[model samples]
Target chain A: MAQIRLSSISKSIDGLHTLNNVTIEAAAGESVVILGPSGCGKSTLLNILAGLIPPDEGQVIIDGQDWTNRTGRVSYMQQKDLLLPSRTILDNVSIPLVLKGTNTKKSRTLAQQHMEEFGLLGFENYYPRQLSGGMKQRAALLRTYLFASDILLLDEPFASLDAITARKMQIWLKDFAHKHSCTIIFVTHDIEEALLLANRIYVLSARPARVLKEIALDDSANSTMVKEEILSILDSETGDTYN
Target chain B: MKKFINTAKKSSALFTLGLLLLLWEKGVSWYEIPAYILPAPTQILDGLLKHHQLLIYHTSTTLLEAVAGLSLAVILALIIGFLLHNLRVLYTAVYPLLVFSQTIPLIVLAVLLPLWFGWGVLPKIIIIVLVCFFPIVISFLNGLDLVDPDQINLFRSMGATKWATFKMVKLPTALPAFFSGLRISATYSIMAAVISEWVGAQRGLGYYMTLQQKSFAIDQVLGAVVVICVLSFIMVKIVDLLNFLLMPWNRNQLVR
Candidate 1:
């Protein structure tokens, strides 16, 4: 059974279509990346899957259960860190459990267990304002994980990071996903990011976006060959060469 | 080095105050002004020492009224602010009324309050509540509404309910601004209480000053004025201390 599925999803804003009849599914523990140019509605589709924004017409099923129009089943992290400024790192990471009605002590202990995994153990007492940009993003990712959902939706989570930090995070996320065995649906504009981290990639066309292609990366010879293919497809759709 | 710089700042502030007192003394002596016109600083200090017990009694009454009024205002403002923040229609409906209430002069409020409630603590308390409530509500609503869209979306995607999002994000973020408004309202509370007492009252520092003024006891009046200033400063300092205790993150940003 698919861990997360969006079938015939359609989203419109102010009478203009943003997503049209989009259908996608990720099996349990599978990692899929959605790739597109700006305004391709990749984020919108992710939002619909996460149940943040309801689709005009569609059904979303998670773990063989219909979850359309429901919230809190999928853990979602946005591009910005969105760490609560007043909360300490530990408190921010523990927010998901707190919202789920866990006792404070239990939630803290649970969050503390994952702090070392994210390299945030020592900075537990630090406020968000005291953290570096990379640390803040890591803390945010930890928050999403602590919610303990079976599926994760990440919308350009590393888009704001410097290139070096983004590369490091990509490696860390891949390792983290493997260890946790959670399905991940990631949205990104960078073909390189999709190539490096995704098991499969879905290319989306511009506004009123529809899926143009779905490339299986597991069969590719190596990362470089996958990158080239994705770049070519993006170039053809955009009509602009990417070096 | 940081400690030395802080000490130097304190010394400079004291020095400026000393200069102002010296000028005040010299002006009074050179002009040979009558004691009734303006008492010298030393004469006012002497009056303060002589009438200390009486001043304390009056001050306690004013402080009680101010504290009670300000406390009630804080509670009302928080409830109203949270409601208006969550409901857009209520905000649009009542926001202009709040602004309009503030434009009505305080003196008019003082006079009207006594007529409605009779000359008592109730009238003075009402005046202070009127003066302090608007700013607290306005600042709190502004802060609560300032919850970032990105943050809201992030929580929404996590399947958080609207109440959960408010509790975890909006409330904590709005606290700094709420405390700021409280601090401002604290000072206003003291001033409003005293001024209302001046319009009509059997007790309070304002009433004491009015009695001294009628008797041409200029030094005593000056002493009462000084006490009022000190009370206001102390309330503001207390609010600052409360802010430090509640929001320690802001303390590091405060310049020495």
Candidate 2:
């Protein structure tokens, strides 16, 4: 069974539909990217899938259970790094375990094991404010991963990063997810980002957004060819065929 | 070398204090001013030494009242701040009443509380709580409410409940602001307690000063004033130390 299923998920805000009867499914360990323009409700859809917000109408099924009204099945990392300024990087990463009632000592130990994987081992004692923008995002990602949920929702996690840093993060994330066999629903405005990471892409419309197209990329394609195809698809959707 | 520089700083501060005393002594000698008008610093020190036991007793009583009141204010402020922060309707409803409470003068509160309660430590402590509560609540609420909305949403998406969100995010973020208000309230607590004692009390620093003044012991009165200033300064320093220990992140971010 698909680990996460959004069945005819419809959401309206202020009487305007954002997701118009959208349905998508991701099998366990698959990486699906929701690609769209600025106001396309891609983040909103990710939020619904994570159970952050309830859809106005429809069901969100995870592991054969309706999680629309249920909670805690999915872990999400937002666009901005929401590291607590008062907490050390180690404490921030251990927060999910702490919330689950794990002892502080054990939680810190568990968090310490993943610090080197995220390139944050030495900086564990540093507070959030001591970190650079890129490092803060890394800490936030580590925190989300530490939650150890079955499904992960990443809402433009690298959107705030500089172009160079963002590219590095994209590569790191792809490797990290693959290594863990993690199920992910990632959202992004960058077509290149979607092409680089996603097995399947769901492109969305401008506002009051609905899915415009869903494309499956050849898993064996070179990075250059994949990037070119995604750019072409985006150009066609935006009616800007200047490329 | 750094230790020497720190010692130099302390010595310079002491030298300035000595210079001020010299100037005061010259003025007293030149004008042949009556001791009742303005006693010399040395005379104040002498008077303080002579009545040290009595001063200690009264100072302790006043300190106890202030400490108790300040503790109560902090607890009430945090509870109210947390409640209002979680519930917007309650915040809007109660915020104006809190503001109104602050507008009432401390002197009026001193007189009114004694009438309401009695001529005891309870009334004085109540006065200190009244004076200190508003600043703490206002600052705490501002801190709690000012958390980044995106941050709140981020935690929400992670399936963090309201209490968890507060414990993990809101409370830690609000610590700096809470401590800032607490510093202000701590100083206010001492002053409020002393003033309430002035209005009605038989034993306290304020009452001791009054008794000394009545007996024409101006030097002792000056001694009491000095003690109060020193006490207030110590309380502020303690709060600063707490801020250092609790929110170490702020230490490095100083603009200077």
Candidate 3:
């Protein structure tokens, strides 16, 4: 497990700041949610943490190691499932192992064992086109899980799925994290999803986003009053010092 | 009834071809058309039968030249396309020139090739390669360009090397486009060979057609054409089979 901490991270794209002096941390084995309006640079923050892109300023320290403008440290799954269309479910799930120079037969065997775990048994030979949207996402998650053991950055992984599937995925993910014991910095705009999954939620502002409010919810705190408070915080001006 | 319908649908094209031949034979008879001008289908068939040995030898030569040039072009195009994709500076400087080269007709180039390379198989094969490689290079470049950025990022996060990403992602993604380009090139390959052979060649179906045309033996010329058509269809089927073998994931959609 890894602890991810972003310290005063600032990013600018084409001279316009997307993130400004924002800091967020996911403690070891913690499930952190980043909540914000659409296009409010929530994904950008996750990208920075995942080392896909660098912040113009500030450091991404994973487990007390400063890593900026680096990659390959975390399992990063974007909003889309991003499964390869050509490969069968088995091949797709085994991509990380296959690309890492493992034996193909061995990779398929390992992936086969986890296919049952991911509820994707009997789909080893089926192509990506043959599966439902939710099945593809599960396979994608299994692939990501197989890539690394410590940290994962998921950017609205279930956003494209139907509401029913999304809820089912949320429950599955919650249980998966509990069993796996990994740090996950998940990005989403859904309030209930954030409340259900996160130990700490960072509510971000619009363009040139900074954390507007950081709410810490206890495990037993599943109250309507808590939901109302977060909604009110989102409706009002972000509590960032102006400019 | 269903079986009958299926059989009818399958035979529809052959039926049309047979009907057209019958009509041509009737038209020639009615018009009192001389064999030298427009022979009956039976006369054309007789030409094929009489010259089968000579036709086979010549057809073999044409096949050798076309297949050789097509294989060389595919290899050259892949190497050149890969280099161009990697070297942005070179691609920018020279890609437009490549596209411009295609606009100059191969027929026009066919004349100059025999002069430059002599009246041999070399000129014909070279002309075939030049005529066919352009579409391949363009399609490959387009395929390589359309690699998904998301997939790239995903691979990068897996700590996949540049070569690894290329092998697993970029290469697979470019396949459909490469096959697409291959289909176009396959259609052009035989035509390009025949067009080159039109300039100068001792043997080949193209040379036979030219010989028969000069002598105004329209039936023999038509026979050579039938052979050319058969060769082209075979090439297309071969390419389709290769596509199927290489990409089984696309099999369901590939046939229909």
Candidate 4:
């Protein structure tokens, strides 16, 4: 288990500002959601945390260590399932284990053991195309989980899924995260999703996204009141004061 | 119902071919065209039957060269594509030259091959490789490029090394494109072998055709043409089978 902090992270791509002094932190075993408008550099923030891209400024500190711009320390899942069409679902999920130098047979066996838990038991030999969209997303999540168990960075993973399926997946994920007790930093444009899943929600402002507000929710908190509050904050332009 | 449509579709093609052959056969007899000028379908069939042993021998020789050259070309393309993908400098340096190689007339090169390598199977194989490798390499490189950037990020985040990413993602993603190129190249392989044989060879359908043409054996020449088309068609079917076997996901029968 690992706790990660992106402190004052800022990035500019080809003279275009993507993220601006965005600071966020997730405690170990906590589910933190970054909610923002579309194209608000939510994915960019996750990418920086994943160590795929270095932030122009600030540091990525994981567990009191400066782990800036270093990859393979965390599991990451992008929006698209991105399953290798050539491989079966079993082989696809086995890839992370194989890449980590586990033997092919052992990797497949390990992946097979988790297939049932992920709701992909019988479809082991089936290709990605044969699976439903929700199933594919589950497989992708499983692949990410298999890569690392401590921390997971998911960027709009269920965004493309249809509403009913997406809702089911969100509920399933909430339970899964609880069961696994892994730290999760899930980025999404859906406010409802953030509120539903997060221990703490970081609402981000549009392009050159900065953290507008951080709200920690408890069971006693009024859902309707918080939803309205976050909605008002999101709709309001940056630099505007809101209670 | 689908099977019926497939059968009808196949019969439609056969019907068209049969009608064309009938017209050609009737027109030759009605117009009193000389056999030496354009052999009728019946005459070509007769020629094929009479020279079956000789034609089969020559076809086997041609087929051998084509298969050998095509196998070598595929291996070379894979090696070159891998290198070109990794070494940016080599890609810029050699990629255009590969395109340039295509621009030079195969006929001209066919003539020159024998001069350099002498009248042997090696020259013919070389000619076929030159003809077949370009498409394979280009399609493979295109497939590699087609991989999603996020997919690469996913792999990197999973602790996959550069080589592992290539082997697991890029290479498999490239297979469909590579097989498509192979399909095109397989058809060309036979023609390329025949073309090289036309320049110089002791055996092969092309060499046999040249000999028959010198003696005004036009029926025999037509027979060789039929054999060439059949061989090329067979090569394409073989490639399709390989594609089907290797890429089951590409099949239309999705369970969902």
Q: Point out where model 4 deviates above 4 Å.
A: A238-243, B1-6, B253-256
Specify the highest-lDDT model's number: 4
lDDT of 3 by residue, A27-54 (tens): 9889999988888888788778778898
lDDT of 4 by residue, B1-256 (tens): 9999988987997989999999999999999999999989999999999999999999999999999999999999999999999899999999899888888988998999899999989999999999899989999999889998888888887778889889888998899889989999999999999989988899999999999999999999999999999999999999988888877888874221
lDDT of 3 by residue, B52-143 (tens): 99999998988888889888989988999889988999999999999888788777889898889988899989988997788888898899
TM of each candidate vs. truth:
0.95, 0.89, 0.96, 0.96
Second chain TM-score for model 4: 0.95
For candidate 3, what is the TM-score? 0.96
**Location of the lowest summed lDDT over 10 successive residues in candidate 2 chain B:** B247-256
RMSD in angstroms between candidate 1 and the native structure over all alpha carbons: 1.9
Docking quality tier of model 3: medium
- Chain B only: TM-score of model 3: 0.95
Scored by TM against the true chain B, the candidates give 0.95, 0.92, 0.95, 0.95
DockQ in order = 0.72, 0.56, 0.76, 0.82
**What TM-score does chain A of model 2 get?**
0.92
Global CA lDDT computed for model 2: 0.85
- Report the TM-score measured on chain A for model 4: 0.95
Where model 1 places Cα greater than 4 Å from the true spot, the runs are A241-243, B1-6
Report the C-alpha lDDT of model 1 over A1-243, residue by residue, as the tens digit: 767778898899889899988888888888899888887788788777767778999899988888887777877887888888878999999988888889888999989998998999799999999998889999988998877546778889999999999999999999889888978898998888888788888888778888878887785458877777777886887788754
lDDT of 2 by residue, B85-167 (tens): 88889988988888987777779878888888989899998888888898898899888877998788767766677899998
